[model samples]
Target chain A: MLNPIEWSSGPDGEIPFGTPFPFSVPFALASPESPGLYLEGVRRIKERGGRLVSLWGSWTSGADPAVLAAFSDAEGLLLYRFRLSADDRSFPSIAFLFPLANRLERAVRDLYGWDPAGLSDQRPWLDHGLWDGPPMVPQDASFQRSPEGADSPQEEYPFVRVEGEGVHEIPVGPIHAGIIEPGHFRFQVVGEKLLRMEERFGFAHKGVRTLFRNRSVSDAARLAGRVSGDSAVAFQTAFSDAVEVATGSPPPRRALWIRSILLERERIANHLGDLGALGNDAGFGFGSVQFGRLKEEFLRTNARIFGHRYLMDTVVPGGVAGDLGRQELALLREECARTKSDVLELKTIYDEHGGLQDRFSGTGWLDPMLAGRWGLGGVAGRASGQMYDLRHSHPVPPYDQVHVPVSISRLGDVSARVQVRFQEVRHSLSFLDSVLEALPEGPFFIQPEETFSPFEGVGWVEGWRGEVLCWVRLGSGGTVLDAHCHDPSWLLWPALEQTVPGNLVADFPLINKSFNLSYSGHDL
Target chain B: MHKILLKIFRTGTLTEPLPEPGPPVKPCPLVRGSLAVRHVDAGSCNACELELHAFTQAFYAPESIGIRFVASPRHADVLLVTGPVTLAMKDALRAAHEAMPDPRYVIALGDCACNGGIFRGSYAVSGGVPEVIPVDGQIPGCPPEPKRILAYLEQLVSAENKD
Candidate 1:
C-alpha cells in the first residue's frame, strides 16, 4: 500500500501531498526557517521508501535564494535538466542526498556554471570539447564571457582514468561501420571479460534544449515529437500533458482515446521489432524472420490506416493533431486480430527453440535493488520487480478509466526483459481492441481557458520505453525559457554497465538490444 | 506440410536480383546488383528510422520502387542512418555498417543523422553521421515519412544507376 503524502511545501512548489494520498505533516518549515527541516523531510520520505520521480527547479529574477537553498536538504535524488539559464543561478544540488545527482549537477554546471555545493562529482557531461565562453547564457542575457581560445580547455576532458593490470582497452568508434547513430565506447577488458566500460555520449547532441528558447508552444511540441523519433506519440503526449497542466486545460475525450490508441500501437510496433531483433541475436533465424514479417505487416497496416507508419505528429497539445476514422479503425481491428493469431503461433515456435533460450535466459541480470537505486523505469525496471508504472502511479486521462495491468518479472535478465515485453504486447493488443470498441466521441481539441505566461509545465507520459518526462518553461511574452525531455534511458544506461558485468563481451549485443535504451532520448 | 511451410517462411526467399540496369553508369563494377535493407530504430521516437521504416511499410515498400530494406544490412547495398548517434551505440552502428564490406553505400537517415536534428546542439549528441565517418547520401527530416525517404533512396539508386 502507498503511504499518504503529508501537506506541506512539497518539493517543486507543490502544496505538500497535493492530492491527499496520506502523510499529515506534524509541522511546517518555511524557506526562511531551518533548511535542515527540508532535509529531514526528504530523509523521512526516503525512509518511507518513496522513490524519486523527478526534481524541477527554476531561476526567476525574484526567486529567493532561501527557497533554493532548502532543496539541498533532500538526499539521494537526481535532477534531470535539459538546459540551464545563462545566469550562474540554480537551485542547490540535491546530489548530497541522491548519488544520481552527480551527472545532472555536472550538466547544470556545464551549461550555467553554478556549481552546486557538496556534490560528490563535478565533471562536465555534455560540453565535451565543444563550447567556449560561458555556456548556455540565455540569448539576451549578459555575463562574464570566457577569454578567447578558452574553449580549448574542453579538448582534454578529465574523464575517469582506468588502471590495473590485465585491463587492456578496446576503443570502439566515434565512427562506427553500422547504420545506427554514433557514440564512443572505451571498454577496459581482461580478455573479453569486461572490467570497466567508459561511455562518451553527446556526439549527436543537437542542442535540442537551447533551440527551444525562442519557439512557440506549438512549434516546441513538434520539436518534442522529434526529440526521439521512434517514440513520437509518447514525447508529444508528455509535452502536451505538461502544457495542459500548466494551462489547466484537459484534452477532449476523443483526443485522449485516440492518443491512447496511438500510444498502444507504437508500443506494439516497437515490441515486435525488438522481439525479432532478440531472436536474431540468439541465432533463431526462424523467430527473427517470423517476427520481422509480422512487424512489417503491422507497420504496413498502420501506414494504410494512419498517414504515417510510426504515427508521427498525430498527437499534439490540447488534443491530438489528427484522428482515426471508422474505416481505419475497422481495418486496424482486423489487422490487430491477424497479428494476435500470428504472434501466438510464433511464440510457440520461440518457446520450442532451445538454442534461442540459452543465450536469452540468464544473459544480463539487473537486480531489483540496483534498479531501485538507479530509479530505473519502463520495461527495464519492471522486469526487476520494481512495480512502478506511470499508467497506475499517476492515472491520467483515458487510462484512468481502464485498468491497465502491467506485466512484471523479477529475473532482471535478457529473457526477463523479453518476457515482460511479450506480456506487455499481449496486454497492449487487448487494450487496443477495447479502446477501439469503446472509442469515445468528442472534440479533438478544446480551446484552453487559462493563459500561461512565463510559467513552467511538467508533462509526463508512460512511453514505450518507460516514463518520458518533459519540462517546458515560458518567459515573458511567451518565449520558451527551457525545454527538457528526460528519457528513461538516463537511468537504464547506467544499469547496462552493471548488467553486462558477468556476461561475455560477445553476448553484449543480445543483452544491450534486449534493454535497447534510447541513445537520442537520453542524449537530449 | 506445416513444417515445410515454416521452413520456407523462415528462409524468406531472395527475390531474383534485378538485372544490372543496362550498361551501369560509366565503367563502375562497384554499383552491383539490387539490394534489400532493413533499418531498426531500437529506441528512436520514430522521427528518423520512421522515415526509413515508412519506406517499406508504405505503398512503395522501397523494394517495389527498386530500393529495398532486407532483414539484414548484410544484404543491403545502402545503409540508411538517422538519430543523434547515441552513446551506447556508436560501435554497434559502425560494426553493422562495416560488416557490409566493399562497394557499400551510406545514407544519413535524417537531419538527426545529418546533424543530430533538433539535437544537433546537444551534449549527448555526436552531431551527424559524417561526424562519426563519411556519409554518401543525406536525407533531412525532423523525420521524413516513408514516401519522402523512398523518394530519396530511389534518387540515390537511380543516380548510382546512371553513374
Candidate 2:
C-alpha cells in the first residue's frame, strides 16, 4: 500500500491527512499551496495513466471550504482535497488546465461563494440569480438576508453570441415538449448548419446537497438515492459505502452481492430505455416499441422482486433493505437469458436496417482526444475510445471476484454509442449469471455503530451513466457535517456541446439521446 | 421485410379497457371529450417521467383511451406537472400553466408534486406544485405507477362523461 502521509504532504508543509477509506485515497492541502499542488497532482495522475473521476466542494462549520477531486489510477481511486479559507476564498482555476474543472469551479462559486480566480466563464451555475443569498453557506446569527418583498424581474441570462452573416440564435426550453426534465439549450446556427451550442441547466436543482446536511446517516442515504432516479442504486451504494467506511464496518458478503445485482439491474434498465429512445429519435418506431416492451418487462420484474420498479430505498447505510430467495434468483436468471436472446436478435435487425444506419453512421462524432480532455466516461466515453470503466479498473468486492469487459469503439457517433450499449448489455447479463450462481450465504445487513468519530469517507461507484463519487464527513454522534454527491453528467454535458456543433438541429435529439446525460444529476 | 411483417403480426394489440373513475374525479362538462395533456417537469427526479412514458407503451396505451400528450400547452386541456417546484423552474411552470386555454386542468403527479416528498422545505425547492400553480388533482407515490396515472385520467374522463 502507498504511504498516505508521504504522498499527501507537499513542499509547502505537511497537509492534514485522514484515514484512507476503502477504494479512496484522501489528502488535504493547505489553502495557500492548494492550487499548485492540485494542478501538479492532476498532471502526475494523468501522466501515470489515471482518469479524473469527479471534482466537488464540501464546506463544514468553522472550517474553510474544501474542494475534493477524485481520480482513478492503476492502484485504485485517489482523492485529493484542497482547503480554501474564508478570508481568501479564491483559488487558481484548474479549468485553465483541465476542461472538466470549468463547470465544477462555477458550481463551487455558485453554492459556496468560493471564486476560481482564472475561470474563463464566470457565469453562475446552478444559480439563476433568484435566491436571497448563497444557500449552501452556513447560516449563523450574523448571516441575515433582506426580507422578501416584491418578486424581482427575471434575470436575463448572458448566452454567448456568435457573429456572422446568416447566423441566428435558437433558444429551446427549460420546459420541453417531452415528459423529460427541464433544461435550456441555445443553438447558434446558419440555416441548417450549426455554428455553436450552449446549455443552461439547474432547473431541477432541489437543494440536494444542502438537504444531506445534519441528517442521520440512514436519512441521508434516502436523499442520495433520489439524486438521479435512474442511478438510484448506484448513488445509494456509494452513500452506503461512504457510511460503512466511516463507521469502520464493511457490510456482509451477502449485502455486497445484492448491491451488485441491483447495480446491474439498474444498468440494464437504463440501457434498454436509452436504446429504444435512440431508435425512436432515428425514426425507427419498430425498435422503440420492441425495446420499450422489453424495458417494461424488466421493470415489472424489478417491481415484483425488489418491491419498486426503480428500486428506490433498497440500499440503506449498512446493507440493502430486502433480500432475494431461490425462486426469485432462478426467475432473474431465466429473464436475463430471455432478454439476451431477444436483444441479440434486435441487434442484427438494427445493424441491417438501412435507414437507422443512414441516420446513425456519421452523426455526432466526438473525437477521442476531446473526450479524454473533457473526462467523459460511461457509454458515451467508451464509444469515443476512452477505455476507462470503473467496474474493470477499480473493482470492489463483488466486481473483484467477477470479470467486467470494457466496451469501446473509435467511431464516436450515435451508431458507436448504440453498439457500446448492446455490448455492455451482453456483458452485464453474463455478469449477473456468474454473480447469482456464486451467490454467497450470509446476513443481508448489519446495524452500524450509532456513534462515529469525526472522520471523512468517500464512496465511488460506477453508475450506469458513469462514475459517481459521494464524499461525507460525520460529526460526533454521526450527524452529517458536510456531504457532496458528484454526478458524471457534469463532464458528459460539455461533450454534448462539442458534438452538436456541426450536426443539423434536427439530429440534436438523436445525438442528445445517444448521450442521455441526466439534467437532475447535473442540476443537483 | 417478411420478418418485420411477421413480427408485427405476431405482436397483436396489448391495450386494456380503461379503469373506472374514482370518487375524486368529478365530471366537468367542458372536458367531455378526448383529453390532451402537456407534461411539465417542474423539478422531478425523472422516475415519474419514466412511469409516464410507460403509459404510451403497448400494455397501457393511453392513446387508445382518448388521452394523448400534446407538444404545447395551447393545444393541451390538462397540465401534468411533476416534482416539487424548484426556484429556477417556478417561472417556467407558471408560464406553461398560463399558456393553457380556459378551463385548464392541472394534475400533480408523484409525491414531490403533491407535497414535495423528500425534497420539501429545501432552500432551492418551493415544496409541491400547488405552491407554484393551482392543482386540480394529485397522483401520489415516490412515482405513481402507470396504472395509477391511467386510473386518475380515467377518473377525469368519467367525471366529464357524468357531466
Candidate 3:
C-alpha cells in the first residue's frame, strides 16, 4: 500500500520554498545580478567549516539564471553556473575559503581559462601540461586536447616544494611495480617514518567532462555511470538526480527502490573485495582466500540475478534500465543471506587473529578536526569518528524506508575502517532484505515529456567511498553543457596524504588498502 | 600434494566445476597471426592483478588454452590492460602499444579496465583501457568473475586456433 511518491517524500526529498537549502546556494548568486554573491556563498560555507566538496564550471553561454537556480535547489545541493562572454571581466575564486579548492581552481583555470585568484597550487590538472592554447575554449567547434607534443617532466610538472633536514625523497611511480593505477607519490622520508607526502595525480585525464558538451542527456547518463566502475550505481544515481531535477522526471517508486538496491549491492561488493585485499596485505592468507572466495561467489550470484557482475547498464536517467522479477528478487535475497553468513564467519576469524588486529589498530589516525577541514566522507571519515553517512544524513529512495545507523570509531586506524565496512555490509544486507520484502508493484520508469532544454542541475549520491557530487549542465536541445563528477577520492586522497605520516613505509599499503580510495574515480 | 588434498577436501570431490558445453570459443580477430599482451595499470589497488594472476595460478591453469601473458610488447599478441588509466600512465600506454608488434589485440579486464569505472574522473586516469589501446574484447566487473575471464581467454585462444 506504499505509494512510491509518498515513499520518496522526506526533508531531503522536499525542496525548501522560502529559503534555499544552506548546502545549495542559488544560481542567481553566480549571475551578473550578484557578481560577488558567489564569493559570499563560499564565505558562508567556509564560515560553517564546510569543505569545498566540488567546484565545476561549464559554458552556459545563454542560459537563464532563474531556471538554473530552480534546478540547483531542487536537488538539495549548492548549484551555480556563470555565463562566459567576451565582455565578462572576472570570475570569483573560492580557494580563499576552502584550501581544497586549490586543485579544482587550477583545473578550471587550465581547462576553461577561468581566472581563479589566490590559488596556492596552480599546476595543470586536466591539461596534462600539453596545450599552450586557451584552457577549455572550443576550437574547431569541439573541446578536445590539442595535438600531442613532447612535454618534459621537469618542465611540465610544477610540484610545490617541501624542504627539511634528513628528508630523503622516495618517489613511487606514475608506473608502479604492480599492475595498479599510475600515480607518483613523492614522500619525504627520514628512515621509515614519512615526514611529508605529495601526490602528483591526473596522469589519466580523459576529456570526459568536455566530452559531455552537446551530447544528449540520456546518452550522458550512460557516460556518467562509467565514470566510476565500483560506484557506478552511485554516479548514475547522482546524474539521474540532476537530470530528473532539470527535466522534472520523477521515477516510479519501484525504480527508485531498485536503484537503491543496486547502489547497496555495489557498496557491499567493493567492500567485500577490499576486505580480502586488506587481509592479504597483513600476511593473513587464510582471511584473504576466504574473503576472496566469498567475493567471487557473491559476484557470480550477482551476475545470475542482475545479468551483470558489477551491475553495469542497470541504472539509467529517470528510472532503472533493467527490470527485476519477483523470482530474481527472491534469488538476490537468498544470495545476500548466503554471503552474510560467510562474511560473518570471516569477521570472527579476522577479529580473533591478533596479528592483524595489532597491525590494523591505531595505525592511521585521521583526527576529526582534520577530517572536518578536509571534508572527508564515507568509510574513511566514519572510521576516524566523523559520523556522517549519506543514507542517514540525506536518505534517498529505499533508504527512507529503512533506517541506517551511522557507524563510527575514535581509534581511526586500519581496524576501525575494517569494522566500519563490516557493519555497513551488514546494514546494507538487512536493508536489501527489507526492500525486497516491501517491493511495490508499479511501472519502473517515467519517460520525459518535455523535449529537452539546455538546463543546469546537480546530482549528489553517497557512494561507497563517500559522497559523489556531480554538476551537470544541459546544452541546446538537451545536449550536455558540461558534466563534472567529483568523486569522494577528491577529499579522501588528500586525507591519505595527511594520515600516512609517522607510519612506516611498509605500513603504507595496509593503511592505503584500508582506505582503498579509487584512483580512476579521482583521475577523471 | 598438500594443495591437491586441500582442493579435494574443500570441494568434497576430486575435480573442479566445469561448464556445460555450448559456450562459444573464438580467437581474437586482431591477433590472427600471434599473441602478445602489454599490461597498463591506469589506477587500481590490485584486485584485477589477482584475477590476472589467477589465470596463471595452478587453480585456474589457463596456459592449456595457449593464452600466455607477455611482458614485452614486441613479443605480445594481445594488450591485456587493467586499472583505470591515470594521467601519468598515458605516455606509457601509448609507448607500450607502439612497441607491440603488428596485429595486436587489446583485452580490457575489470571495472576500471573497461571504462575507468570507479576511478573514472580521478586526477590520474586517462579513461578505460580501450582509450589507451585498440581493444577487441572488454571483460567488465570489479576484477571480472574468474569464469568470465576464463571464457574470454578461451575465445581468444579459439580465435587463434581458427587462424
The clash numbers for all candidates, in the given order, read: 58, 1, 52
Query: lDDT score of model 3?
Result: 0.65
lDDT of 2: 0.82
Per-residue CA lDDT of model 3 for B46-103, tens digit only, reads 5566456444433354555566666566777777788666555667777877877766
TM (B chain), model 2: 0.93
First chain TM-score, candidate 2? 0.93
Off by over 4 Å in 3: A1-35, A60-76, A81-90, A132-135, A140-156, A160-166, A475-477, B1-38, B42-79, B82-88, B94-145, B151-163
Ranked by lDDT, top first: 2, 3, 1
After superposition, the stretches of candidate 2 with alpha carbons farther than 4 Å from their true spots are A1-34, A141-154
lDDT of 1 by residue, A1-524 (tens): 12233323434642211111111101122332233444565555556655555443333343222222111112212222222333534345566665555565555555554555556554556655555543455544455542221233455545555678876777765544333444566677778786666666655555567667677778888888877767888888888776665565667889888888889899998899888878987887656556666776676676777666677777877888767788888988887888888777777777766788888888888888888765667998999887777776555556777768978999999889988988898888888888888888878887643443455456667899997877666555545556677777766777777877656778877887898777666656
Q: Judged by TM-score, which candidate is best?
A: 2
Model 1 off-target regions past 4 Å? Answer: A1-38, A55-91, A142-152, A156-165, A450-452, A475-479, B1-30, B34-46, B50-108, B111-142, B145-163
- The CAPRI category of model 2 is high
**Residue range with the least summed lDDT across 10 consecutive positions in model 1 chain A:** A17-26
Evaluate model 1: give its lDDT. Answer: 0.63
lDDT of 3 by residue, A357-451 (tens): 99888787777788866666689998888866767766766776688788787677889999999998898888888898888889888874343
Alpha-carbon error at B77 in model 3, in Å? 10
